[model samples]
Target: MPDITTSAVAPTRLRIPRQRGQAPGTSPSGPILREHIDAMIDLHPGGLTWRRTFPGTLDHIPHARHFTRYLLADSDHRHDAELIAGELSANAVRHTASGRPHGTFIVEINRTTTTITIAVYDCGWGGVPRFGRLFGIDAEYGRGLTIVAALADQVGYEGAEEVGHRVWARMVQPSG
Candidate 1:
């Protein structure tokens, strides 16, 4: 594949028209309001942390995956992070308004000495994923979180799509 970075980055912009009264950024419950933000800033932790915003479309998932792969290239959880990144990014593309025109999602990676946390923040246009192990072998979709939970040391959803839905997973190396 051509260098994804150097490749003409035009097709990622959506040409689809927006619907009337339906804003591009919103939670399914309503317009994202304050009081839902679980805002916390890292105080320059000892390792690496990175964040980026990408157009919420299928084409951009690989970019996020690639970035995650590059960032965790040295970690024992590199493969787990990459898979979690791909699954989370694809879920954002498929289940949220982030996939629409003018919609976007943010990818965040926080790596410490023994763990890497991967998160995808999407414009919440759908129901928050629930924990019921909600899947079946015959189903064609909806196993993102299940896979994430299985692979990660911890997993969670924070903030509404109104404030942006944050789905995160962390993978850690076992102590010696």
Candidate 2:
């Protein structure tokens, strides 16, 4: 593996084309999204792994699993691939506090020579993650951050300035 101390670099933005006229489920949005993520993975000098998480709701898991399988089939490191389904499921639970039961979440993976980053963007009720003291020890909720922290070297939120919200994790890759 490359030196893990190398400074982190921003991912190169790829132009994702909008599918016009195509119905929501008819067009190739999922495949296009997967392709964009694969391009990012290709930029990594090291091997790459990817996974996706969906809403906890039964309706969304199929879509999530479909996209995740597409990405994982092309991955080189399945073992290190972050298990994001649980995190997104938790976010869905939080967002559904309103009466609406429908939402979507996406997870993308990318890496550089030494660092790997996983990002989960959701159309959830947006807010920064509440850390310690926000939830009690016996509480079943609020454990998403703990899972993220344990699995990731660093984690943070972004997109407060935008419509949707994204949570990301960056970690040093283990040598192959």
Identify the candidate with maximal TM-score.
1
lDDT of candidates 1 onward, in order: 0.74, 0.55
Model 1 lDDT-worst window of ten: 32-41
Tens digit of per-residue lDDT, candidate 1, span 90-172: 88878888888988889999866566789999898766865447777899777777888889878888887576689899777
lDDT computed for candidate 1: 0.74
* Local accuracy of candidate 2 as per-residue lDDT tens digits, 56-107: 4646644654454444443343323435544644464455321145555666
Give candidate 1's TM-score. Answer: 0.70
For model 1, the superposed segments whose C-alpha errors exceed 4 Å read 1-43
Q: Name the regions of candidate 2 deviating beyond 4 angstroms.
A: 1-80, 96-102, 132-134
How far is 164's C-alpha from truth in model 1 (Å)?
A: 1.6
Cα displacement (angstroms), candidate 1, residue 144, comes to 1.7
